[model samples]
Target: MTPDDERFDAKTTVLIETVGHHVQEEETDWFPKVRDALGRKELQEIGARMRDVRATAPHRPEHPGSLRAADALLG
Candidate 1:
């Protein structure tokens, strides 16, 4: 849908708000529990692996609209 479309804008707003809430809860509540469960050593290992994977990830989107879609979902 076009950026000017009301329906698209409404959906985008809702999606962004929902994602913000999820991130807040994850940071304040879930992440601590997960960190305790995973422990520092395992978390460090995961972080290193993630850094390695991210180094290989595409910096730019592959298609015309992919960047916008990725921003909406990943931001």
Candidate 2:
């Protein structure tokens, strides 16, 4: 494999590990703290605000080759 291939593999491994750690922390610690702090009505309001933001957000253009590359990787 090329040096670029090796670097990409390393970066992908780091990204997966970092995301896994963050997800675990959110599930085990942060989420519980948030649930305890925010009442149901407040949580519902926050969700509504998030939906509004998502509805109004502008679309971002993807790199020309990225979708094909991603499909190839997953295919």
Candidate 3:
């Protein structure tokens, strides 16, 4: 593959890693706060809304920022 292709791949990897870290932080930090603050019915409704969001979201390639970060880290 071309150097450019390799760079793109590297960036995407870093972006994915960043997202994983964010997910962990959300679960550990924000989720508890949300759970405590919101009622069960409210939380369940929010969960349904989130599921709808995920279901309707369009797919796209990784962001350019992520690609650049990955390339820089790999390089």
Candidate 4:
């Protein structure tokens, strides 16, 4: 393999491993603490705030070609 190909593979491996570690920590540690600390009413309030924030967030236009590229990758 070329040097560029090897470097790309190494970088991809590191990215995947880092994300997997973060997800594992969140599922096993952070989420349990959050669930234990928040009561049902508080959780609901937080969810409502998140929904409001998302609803009011500004929209940005995507590049015209991005949809096709995303479909090609995700299909």
Q: Which has the greatest lDDT?
A: 1
- Sort all candidates by lDDT, best to worst: 1, 2, 4, 3
Model 4's TM-score against the true structure? 0.59
Reference-based lDDT, residue 56, model 2? 41
Ten consecutive residues with minimal summed lDDT in candidate 1? 66-75
- The segments of candidate 2 whose C-alpha lies over 4 angstroms from its true place after superposition are 1-5, 58-75
TM-score each candidate. Answer: 0.67, 0.68, 0.57, 0.59
lDDT tens string, model 4, 1-75? Answer: 564885888988888999999999999999899999999898898777657655544454375765654454345
In candidate 3, where is summed lDDT lowest over 10 consecutive residues?
Answer: 66-75
Model 3 per-residue lDDT tens digits across residues 1-75:
454885888888888999999999999999999999999999888677667655544455365565554454344
Candidate 1 has a TM-score of 0.67
Q: Which pairs of residues collide in candidate 3?
A: 11-67, 11-70
Estimate, for each residue in 3-42, the C-alpha lDDT of model 2 and write its tens digit: 4885888888888999999999999999999999999999
Per-residue error (Å), model 2, residue 32: 0.3
lDDT of each: 0.78, 0.75, 0.74, 0.74
Q: Spell out the clash pairs found in candidate 1.
A: none
Could you give candidate 1's per-residue lDDT for residues 28-54 as a string of tens digits? 999999988997898898778667656
Better of 2 and 3 by lDDT: 2
User: Arrange candidates by TM-score, highest first: which order?
Assistant: 2, 1, 4, 3
What does the lDDT come to for candidate 1?
Answer: 0.78
